[model samples]
Target chain A: MTPQTGRSAGPGVPRGDLPHRAGATGWFDTRHRHLGDWAFVVNRLSGLGLVAYLYLHLVILSQLARGPEAWGGFLAIATSPPVLLFDVLLLAGLLAHAFNGIRVTLLGLGLVASRQKALWVALMGMAVLIALAGASRILGVTS
Target chain B: MATLLQTPRPGADADPAAPARTLRVRRHRRGDSAEGWDRYTAPVGPRTTVLDALTWVRAHLDASLNLRHSCLHASCGTCGMRVNGRDVLACVTRLEDLPPGEVSVEPLRNQPLVSDLVVDIESLYESLDGVRLPLVRTSEGAPGSTPAEGVGHLTRFEDCVECGLCVSACPIVASDPEYAGPAVLGAAWRLVAEPRDRDPEPAYALVDGEQGAWRCHLAFECNEVCPTDALPAEEIARLRGILLRHRVVRWLQRHARPEEVQP
Candidate 1:
């Protein structure tokens, strides 16, 4: 389909004379082209996951409602290698989602117009933090 | 009757200006049939509008031409048609101003097409109808009871012609089928933001469900294409802020209740 043109064209040239190009060029281009949509979708899904984690953590903490035996079992399940790995993954997704959301929020608020590089930097920072904290906990360096 | 004196004729033939170029308009013959372009000659003039050319074609060239237009001016808001693949007011688009070539006219996208160059706008109208575009009045006295001294900001929002260009151009509408879309939200924002709108609580609940303003990711495509300067992005943003604040306030109120408080 031809791109719409207005009286802006010079005489004798048709609007569709120009080559047809898709709105997006490649995978990277689409990611940036539909950045708002992608960001919203990723943020919402990750937020839901984080909310689930919050509820799960609250429930595990509510083991205080039970005796130490129950709390011991819950902690064991949580600290198991697989569960710990999943937790790390969840934390990574959460941080990425949140930092990206904040970046978008800043852009939307006009607090920052040239936010692309800044968004990447913020996301990388979150990844580093998540990796460091998760590795330290898993390697028994700290709780 | 007295006989009048006869004058001699010198001209053997008279020729007027050459006919202007033919404009090929797409005709949607059937509900399921593919659309085809049908050429119709039009008089070229600097000030001639696309709507005028279409009207001339319909009147003299093809009476079977199907299109919806009303109020040759933009105020009536009915003459919105896609000119050259973009949504524009046909009445306001002068032919001479367009590129000197074949201009493709089509029905508005993301909506049902009733016929050539006419899309069903009832869906948008229904969405607007669904919004409770008013604030409840207090029992003591009516809101806006004082003389309607117009505030420029609020009153300008009321100038929405409901042309649906914003809706057509909106990326949200393209992605989410259930979105109330920009036109409806634009109208809703007018009432929601009105200074005299009493009991704004109702406006908060009006858009809670699927594809409401919350679905809008602040693309601002609606704001960019609005024929009138009704910035829908600003309005939707304000609505989001109001709704979030209201929820937070309600949560605080509930938590602060005496029964919920522990000594």
Candidate 2:
């Protein structure tokens, strides 16, 4: 949380979290938000989830330190139906975040600002199709 | 301001022939610790605006109910508020065009509340001043129209209207109070795009930083809620490109030999 530059509202006058202003925690408050709002919230959430998964993955890979028996036991748990279901969801999150990230970067660099909504829909559509294919491959083999 | 303390309009709650709707308005006082809503049932015809409904409430139901409006048109931008969770000018938002049901009218978000349905707009104006863009411009594409006797072009005052609707609709502004929001950036872009008689490089320099234009996440909610179509999101991106190209040129200049100075 780096410090922001000084604001014009000055410093001391408290800016109250007025209702319907969608405070810091209200990014996901989807009453009448636009598609870009939803895309932004989804991107942030998926990024956070991915970061947490990275740490868990390192710990899971540490099973090798306990010898071959421990590693095999972990692999058995990993291949179960519930674990495979989690994998499918994880793939969806990754694809959604990655594709939207590309769109955000392109727009931020002033590439295509006019058709941003259309660009978002196109990128997310591709993400959905890829996620569906990956989910079928993962779940179908398990079942 | 709505005329208050007069005899209550007869059709507010008693008439059986006129159409009516319930308005769920957010209420807050200066010293109140929390906020809540007060529902007022007002007699509304098809063309009755949200401002008209609110004024009706002030006249017939609750005299203490507070709001602000000047020109009973969208040009003033003083009647901005959220109707059905979207920012709009209350003077133009007719009841018939809104989502059918009890309409929820809340004050603009992310700013301090002065009273019911009116936020303290001092900060919004202060932010505009910080950018230093004169809020006036010539109307575009008004060709073949008459100009003043000595003037070359017919000029219009402004289009942005200083409504703060873009600021309210922006999520970045909601999260980071210091972020130079859509309206400011939009003005900055205009300054840079057409400097007129003045240099715009300083205006570009003002917004080259993180809290300036780079902080935007391209939500484009500002563009959506902007009543004037100023397209702040697009302008912010343009500002970023200018800053990026300037930096690249400076870098090249630094690394170039003394021959680069001969030109």
Candidate 3:
């Protein structure tokens, strides 16, 4: 073992010049090279996207104050093919965020901490299944 | 400061034409000094481990290389280090399991680096010690007396082995030094979960601070890197549950007794 004494950098001391910060972007960038880590990043990103969409949704709803013609015109543009595709993407994000949330909650409750990788795979699979079902219904493929 | 050392030896019992594989080790001269990675190539056998490669490098090439290992097996956690950016027991991490080409070895992160591949684990032990955990009996029994009936079915709580790998893998401890990492909180959880512990209240109070269970983000990195299967992330989650229940109960009690509330 290396001699413990005379080590200038002790525990709790910051090594400023080190190549990487302790838990900065390194946590998500370098260290997070596994499936579980990717799940966490995706969860956070999807959550933020959902929040942004919610604000935009509220803004769109407030267009009703401009009268029926304005509101109807906005709805007509919103339901166009491009907007519909964006909505589908939003739905995918919502499903991913919701399913991953359940997985994280179960893990926090210590229900399936050991089988987290399997749980993640199962939840992501379920998310894709639900998203596909919702997409077919929204795009008039199932009707 | 990258030095490549290659050693060639013909095998007596096995095929002699097998090319040797290189082990790349990241080394730091001092705790505060700049770091450099060195490469050492040694003949790989069926049972060669990362620890064996380090041993070979030290024996043949560099005497100044510093590392710690004992038992040459996974029993002793002294050889814990980051192999290929992941925390693992060097004694048990086989070279064959690593990706083809080079295997990188470095000291455990989030701790005081004493020298090459040697981290100061005293702080981890001190954090566990600060909890002042004791097994409190729920029944009217002496300290050394046998347990009463019906209490034997409680699940056994595995104690932290002080390997420091979990702490090294903990991002909370890496960023914030004040936060007591998984190993410490996991030990606290084991004591708090003891069925016979009359007053787990003290254990709860110990971890009630901002740097305690509340700070954990439930990343599960500690659980992923734990060599002993101690499951520190699960323990931290359990501790969070206990602390949450405690806060809710305390809030309810305070609201229930309106007369005791001072104006």
Best-performing candidate as measured by DockQ: 2
Off by over 4 Å in 3: A1-22, A27-38, A58-73, A109-122, B8-19, B31-33, B133-159, B195-199, B251-263
Which candidate should be chosen as best, given TM-score against the real structure? 2
Residue pairs with clashing backbones, model 2: none
lDDT: the better of candidates 1 and 2: 2
| Candidate rank order under lDDT | 2, 3, 1
| Two-way TM-score contest, 1 vs 2, winner | 2
State which candidate, 1 or 3, has the greater TM-score.
Answer: 3
Sorted by TM-score, highest first, which candidate order results?
2, 3, 1
Model 3 has an lDDT value of: 0.74
Tens-digit lDDT track of model 1 for B1-263:
11111221222221135235456676653332345566666665657788987886676557767888888888877878778766788888888888887666666666666666776788777776666455333332355555334344555565677778777666556645567777776666666666363554545555444666677666555565567776676677666665566677778777897876555
What residue pairs clash in candidate 3, if any at all?
Answer: none
DockQ of 2: 0.26
Candidate 1 residue pairs in backbone clash: A7-B97, A7-B98
Error of 3 at A142 (Å): 2.6
Cα lDDT of model 2 by residue, B1-263, tens digit? 12222333576344556777888888775555467676777877868999998998877778878899999988888999999989899999999998778899999987777888998778778777766665333543357665444232111214778888888888888878778888888877767655567677767666886678888988888888888767788778777776788788878888889788436
